[model samples]
Target: MLLLLLGYDAINWFDGRFSLPTPGMLAAPCEFIDVVVTERAAVTGDQSAVAITFAAPDGSPLPAWSAGAHIDVTLPSGTVRQYSLCGDPTDQSSYRIAVRLIQDGRGGSAEVHSALTVGTEFQVARPRNAFPLAVGGYNQTTSAVRLIAGGIGVTPILPMLDMLDRTATPWSMIYCGRTRDSLAFLSELARFGDRVTIHEDATYGPASAEELLGDLTVSSAVYTCGPPPMIDALRAALVDRPDVEFHYERFSLAPVVDGREFDLRFASSGEVVRVAADQTALSAILGARPDATYSCQQGFCRSCAVRVLDGAPEHRSTALSPGELDAGYFLPCVSRSEGCLTIDM
Candidate 1:
């Protein structure tokens, strides 16, 4: 018995469950409703992607969400990640999200891929939509629409396609991926038929602006979700088509542009936070105030909006109105300071 205790029990050799116990599975807060992982399915042939479906524990209807909406998923490791809602928004009973394994990412995708079982429990914040369909109704506008998706970026665009098709809106889309097997949501996109274009980097060598835009010379509304490089190329291409209403959302943070290094003094604690030329003020300040809240790192959401107490703040966020910016409100996620600035965070 002692040898058995030392051999298989102490060392745990027979049933090797060497993995650590995760947090939030046994007892979660009352504030967050529990959603059990109801199903997990392979979404890509590469075995690097999965679609997870969750439902309320009590079979109650979940919160209603729209296309381009995302929810913050609190993982077992206490990591919070935002995933786009790829399922039909009208299906209020449950929600589905697809995740692609990013080996070089911050380990969130790897956790989702390896740890999320069908019966796993987790919490998800209420859905928030930052990038919404420009035209909700088909009869409201006559302008054409262009939807572009890159790789796993197709998650958010899937619901958009559903909404646009349901509303009878005229639109076309370009889905770019490294290979045909690497792309997710192909079955969903296939229903759209010739309206969808599949551009594989394996064959096309990467989509150029011209290939992406594809005779989009008219004054149309263009919506895109993809990697930063794809978004940047599309942005540069649209520089000439000023009439096109360009709305884009990417999974990654927007690169800080034209940032100047400066010191940020907090009004509450008088803590001087240094901002690097390439780092966002919000990113730098998080080291000091871990309790600070922010969403939509792209600056569309005003979750990180702080009041400027002193010094000059270069307002780069598109969220704040002219009156809001003039009234000392600034978004640190994208805004920077020219001089030593004081803010009431």
Candidate 2:
């Protein structure tokens, strides 16, 4: 139970609780430290999912985490990416996370797939949870729980399966991927007996959220994580069940925005750049200073968030709420300005 307060906030790991707030997040930014990779291996036949175990550089026991917790790893390309902890929460010796390479992703996945190896070390932030199991505040009883995942989204739900089974709490899972080969941890998920149902897009019939969640009881809680399109469909399908709490983790950004051309003025650099209708503020900023810090160019990751000194922005990111927008913070990756804007680069 190592509870430490490195700054204004504390990462309390006592009693199985840990909190590491990131910048552009609601809470203040917390400390991030270095960790070494103990092992790295491809778990799937297609070699798309790479499972890597991380431990303290000095071989000290890492912090304890519960299901649905994720760690931010600084990839080799200097891109910070968040991955779900798919291994056992009871294992305090080390932390394990699976990375699924996205063919078209913005280099983070590619770096994780190719660069990470045994004996390699990288910086990782403490675990954080935007999604949690049916615990104290969830209001979900132990009677029944439903978990759903789309494609690589299954990473987060993997640990929940073990947690539910340990408590003897009845639960089920719906995993949907493009093809059978693309599904990671199928053998691990198969041990759940009839509790897990997988849907492959290559098959004539794909998994249907309506069919699986249509009969869900009002008392049940549904946890899902996936791309924006799949999540949007699930959200729309389950709209009628307001009593059912739908917790989700989105990996990618929302659909593209129909933005209008605008001007972005760097307050310190005295440089004004034009953002075309099809261009993003990040692209314009990068053109000005190629060495600018950024990752997950999709608005989902808050790495590109900057202080807005002036002008109203056409907020397209789900990461920032109305209060955050009013607080002079914005994600330049997908967020645009109304006409003219000034930012702190």
Top candidate, metric lDDT = 1
Q: What lDDT would candidate 1 get against the real structure? A: 0.74
lDDT (tens digit, per residue) of candidate 2 on 28-85: 2445777888998787768888889888899887877888887767765555676788
Residue 173 in model 2: lDDT: 85
Query: Once model 2 is optimally superposed onto the true structure by TM-score, how far is the C-alpha of residue 116 displaced, in angstroms?
Result: 1.6
Alpha-carbon runs more than 4 Å astray in model 2: 1-30, 136-139, 212-214, 256-261, 268-271, 274-280, 296-303, 313-329, 334-337
Show model 1 residue runs off by greater than 4 Å: 1-32, 136-139, 266-273, 286-295, 300-310, 318-331, 343-345
Residue 62, candidate 1: Cα error in Å is: 1.2
The models' CA-based lDDT, in order, is 0.74, 0.71
Best by TM-score: 1
